[model samples]
Target chain A: MKADTNLSEGSGIPAEARKILTQIETDRAAYKRKLVISFIILAIAMIMVLIALKLDFRFMKNQLPFIFAGMGYTLLVSFMAISLACFLAVVGALGRLSKNPVFNSIASSYVSLIRGTPLLVQVYMWYLALPQIGKALEGYGFTGIQAFFTLPALTAGILALGVCYGAYMTETVRAGIQSIDPGQTEAANALGMTRSQTMKRIIFPQALRVIIPPVSNEFIAMIKDSSLVSLMGVWELSYRAIKMGRRHFQSLEMLITVALIYWMMCILLQYFQEKLETHMARGDRSIR
Target chain B: MMENDSPMVKITNIHKVFPQDVHVLCGIDLEVKKGETVAILGASGSGKSTLLRCINFLEEPTAGTVEVDGITIEAGENDKLRNGRIRDIRKRTGMCFQAFNLFPHMTVLENIIEGPVTVLRQKKEAATAYAEQLLQWIGLSEKSDEHPSRLSGGQQQRVAIARSLAMKPKVMLFDEPTSALDPELVGEVVEVMERLAKEGMTIVAVTHELHFARDVADRILIMDNGNWVEQGPPEKIFNNPEQERTRQFLAHIL
Candidate 1:
């Protein structure tokens, strides 16, 4: 309370307001400590549940190799989808930020439509509607119709996920770009750098510091969202789990096994995210 | 057509209006010959800074014609100067900012060399060599490798001047270059500007430092309410101001 009063005195904030703020800070810290203890207890309880199910876990053990094999596919799909999403996100961010009415409208519409509709519906659209268009093109005697529009389920899943995530990431990218002080751009312009040159050399490089952390978050979320692709018959973690569980009527065990694997994968992704954040923050003097 | 006789910077009938229809600069006309230093003094909202910014198209004049180093550009129907001509005009002038915008991510040396290497297509080795020279001139040779964030306010501002000078522009513009510095730090930046003036760099500066204006300026112009209210030599303007507003302003600031 003495420290709080001293801080309030120096800041010129009323003592009453400082008291309320100090109370809120104390309450939040206490809540966080309690939450940490609760999480440890929850982990112990989960381990006990695993021990109780050890008797019937033999079948789940046998299926682990089959389901674990799907990790490779999940990583591959997510990697490719993220790459595509990064490209689309840059273009979408530019369009949204551009002064041209046409570009602004197009970017706004794409983000609105994709965010408004369900990802599930978009996935199904790619799988079903694309082939219908292919057939229609074949009737019209388009020579490359078969190859161009013959949409594979895996490809459809990747495209759907990429497009959906790209829309969300556009907002993150735009905000990162906007966070830079306008004075930096004015200085660059005064030095005679073209608009494109300024963006490539000054703006984007600086924006990467703000962008990388959120982008890594999106990548982690994308790993979980990749499971949605299983609906299209892709042999990812969830799809394999469903098929094996249904064949032997061990659905609960199969589902629990895949969930644990997903959790472990997220933990690994989180470690990488922190490493990347630290790397990007190297030039920032305040971080150390 | 008057190539040799024209002033280095000749701005004709400039006006600036914001989107809300607030006229910040109203029908301003000015000229600066080669090797002449003009200081603009005004109250905070008098548009002196806006007038300096328009010379290089940093803040495009809402309506005007600007000619710098024999190249003329007029604001088109959309109230924007042609992009090509704007870049051309900007290349002919170096601008120092109030806040010392020195590209915080770069070291002092890198900030100075960036313009020449990127815009002028100079070799990296040559740009770096010249940047080292500039750092020496600013009395900051030891601080070249240090980032802007690591330097003191005075050091940062000196580096900003060195950064602008690297371009080798025909004229230099200073927009309240010392207003953001501490009282103790303002002297160092003013020292550098004084050195530049002695070396005959054509300069147009908007400043609140009247003593700096009185000591270094050839001509001093006073602006108020979006237009020029008085103009004369520094001695005449400071010692024998004819207008009541000029006398009042000088009395307050002096």
Candidate 2:
């Protein structure tokens, strides 16, 4: 009976609702200020672009579709690479947590080796060194399909991006695991659940709130960096941009168009990321 | 479905040692009767908590045996029991942490039913009914959909107790349940524990709460430097302590 009264006390219209409403209004005002500041910053940056190269906007209309075609490739490469990275990341994280010496060492070396080397070198290795691997396979009494295999440019690009991002994701997942309090696992263990069950049911769900933001950031960056695939001749956005520019001899126009495309993509992605973060946060919120 | 004839718990010659020559539990020897409430008290670093951990096998004893309800934690030079059996032992013992480590992700109802559905494989309807009852017992029925962050520290601790209770453990261990809570909120959680005590649950509590130690405890064992200094009925131990160290601790706390 007593606790019932207290429960009613907690929910019967919070006294600070007015204050909270005012705070919300203040936040709205802050948002408007932020928008203005961003607009000003963009305007200034655009002016510099015009002044530096004597740019003309009339050409922007002509080049838009060509630029977008390149963007399509960039987007494809990033999406495929990110999906692969997610698989590698989850498996790699599990490997790092495994008790076996070999699993832990292999995962550790993967993260360590990838993180230690430059991304450019890794791209080169995947492109240039793989033929040697194929030839070696041929020497090992392997002939038909295995002997003379060749990775497509797109495959090489995906491998480079996936392997690089997976290393970073491994750490993100590790931090997410480490950030969770030890007691959650202890409680799960105290329950009749196995190790994997505990991780899946208790640890992973909570870790998502921490993991989502960083992973989204990585995906956005990958979109821009997918241009690196141009080196391997994957005719993605940047590759097409360079080709289009060389043909037109209006390199500045092509580059400016490419920059605008990236800006639009980043903006759209940033909005979605914010929405997702808020959505994930709703589960853990205690309205009081 | 626990049987009356099954041994609830049995522990013998539990020992633990740490590096740098520090001994956490030199040789812990204790037995808890089914439906008995025992309170263990120690000044500080006396291994009272360690002894409880050993019972739960959270910390494996360096060289001894512990059994709960006919299940033993110690193996013969090598652990032979399958992984599932070990989990059974853990499920049978409900533990209330001082800091109230509630899973922040789940709702209060979800927290309570997690062990039941995930571990015991109880159906959702049954687990929900049981969690509702437990939450009622802890006075958190209305807050079932709320997260731990929305609740106060005392409320979170009560939710933690409800979460543990959802599993229907045979024995419960309270490691200073009220220590992390504010003074104002301590009584509510204590009231719930007092009811649990009255229900004749087998409980082992380590606490500095003199009042609870005085009122609900059937027996009080005092520890100092990883050894039991003395133990007896609550009245005799609190009113007329036999050991000098016990007296000094009582005086310091009182």
Candidate 3:
């Protein structure tokens, strides 16, 4: 406070300006203090609730290593699936934007069919129904078809998640692409750029800035949704937690532990997403 | 064979009808000779901008033909052929919009070089060199690395003109280039345009600035509704327009 006054006086700030600055500084200090107090209160409330719940800390600790070990598979599936989803989303968005009726119909139908069905049903179809169809195809004398259709649990999980998320992300991608001003396209066209050239050089670059935050959001949701693979015996986080809990008769403890783990992973992803948002927004003067 | 005498830009019976029967351009015929500057003055919604847009096929005309530099694209042609011809016309014509639609993602130099590098397939180094020269000509060499959003409206408009010029187009089309600028900032953009005009660039400008029309334009055309009512030398149109519609329009604006 002394230093602030000294600087203000040395700088010869007007009295009115000095008063406003001091008020702003005081408000900032009060805000910081309030935030700290709120955090402490929340932390205490969480501890009290946990104590009241009488959770099995010892059992939860024993199961931690096994459940944590499954994080690798969870992250691996999510990473691969998100990559596939991104590729499909770009292709789907292009198809949606295409003037060709055939492409538009196919893209719209894909989005509709996938989004209309439940992810659980889609997962079951990938894991179980595909092999049945392959067998039926084999009955038609198509050799080696069953082998092609019979995917491993991991591949089926990735496919289900990727294809499902791809449909949703297609709309996100389309909105992002459409968010660009039509003048940008006209400018590119006036400069003699072909449609594809304009899309690649001008439209997509601008659209990616608008698309990324939501894409990251979808990815975070995908991380949790990946637990659906546990139903297919993929032995991921939830799978391991469930197996351990049933064996030890500490289902509540294990469930809560796994939930916290998922929460923590999402938090980490959210932190990185914020960093990326800031990085992408650096060029936009309006945001600052 | 008589390239010097032939019109550089010729529009015959150009008509543009938007959906729901909005006739934006109606049977407009215009001819711009080589190195000639034509200023089209009109009030808001007078279709002057639409007429300019139709020249480059930015807005496809409902009916008519646009011939730029001996290449003609007629309305209702086969899609593939018409698109190819439209591209050819666009290649030869540089357009400056009222909104100064510089690619917000690119720096000033990058925005100028994008057309040459991507469309013209020039070497990046050569495009950059030319862009730098154009930037200097526009007196925005210091803003080469700055993004469009960082620049003022006038600066952005000047950069937009420089971006168009880097293409070395046969004809420059300005669609109310100074309309979006602050009153004080309009002169910089106007000055740059005046320089381009003095350098003998073939230009078709749709504008409201009466002074620019009077001083720089070789011919002045006053448009009302969707058709030009009076067209002549700057003095004749500004001082002694023969049409009552032109007189009324001039009176309102002046």
**Candidate 1 residue-wise lDDT, B1-254, digit = tens:** 46546799998899999789989999999999888899999989889998898888888789988889888888654535568778888888999999888887788899999999989999999999999999999999998888898898889889988999999999999999999988999999999998999999999999988667999999999999789989999999999998999998898889
Candidate 3: tens digits of C-alpha lDDT, residues A138-218: 999998999999989999999999999999999999999999999999999999899999999999999999999999999
| lDDT per residue as tens, model 3, B1-254 | 59988999999999999999999888999999999999999888999999999999889889999899999988878776777788889989999999999999898999999998998899999999999999999999999998888899999999999999988999999999998989999999999999999999999999888778999999999888898888999999888889999888889878
Please give the ranking of all candidate structures by TM-score, highest first, separated by commas: 3, 1, 2
- Model 2 agreement with the true structure over A1-288: per-residue lDDT tens digits: 353354456665465764565577688899999999999999999789787877766766777776677767788899999999989998899889889999999999999999999988888888878878888888887776443456777888898999999999999998898888897887777666788888999999888788999999999999988889899987777777778888878788778778778889999999999999888777546422
DockQ of each: 0.50, 0.41, 0.64
- DockQ winner: 3
Evaluate all candidate structures by whole-model CA lDDT and list the values in order: 0.89, 0.83, 0.92
Model 1 docking grade: medium
The sequence of per-residue lDDT tens digits that candidate 1 reaches over residues A1-288 is: 576666656677777877778888899899999999999999999889877876358898999999998988899889999999998899999999999999999999999999999988998888888878888888898867867876888898889999999999999999999988898899999999999989987888788789999999999999999998899888999999999999998888999999989999999999999988777777667211
What is the lDDT, from 0 to 100, of the residue B198 in candidate 3? 93
Worst 10 residues of 1 chain A by lDDT: A279-288
Superior candidate under TM-score, 2 versus 3: 3
User: How many angstroms is residue B246 displaced in model 1 relative to the true structure, after the best TM-score fit?
Assistant: 0.8
- Output the TM-score of candidate 2: 0.90
| RMSD of each candidate relative to the true structure | 5.0, 5.5, 2.3
* Candidate 1 vs 2: which has more lDDT: 1
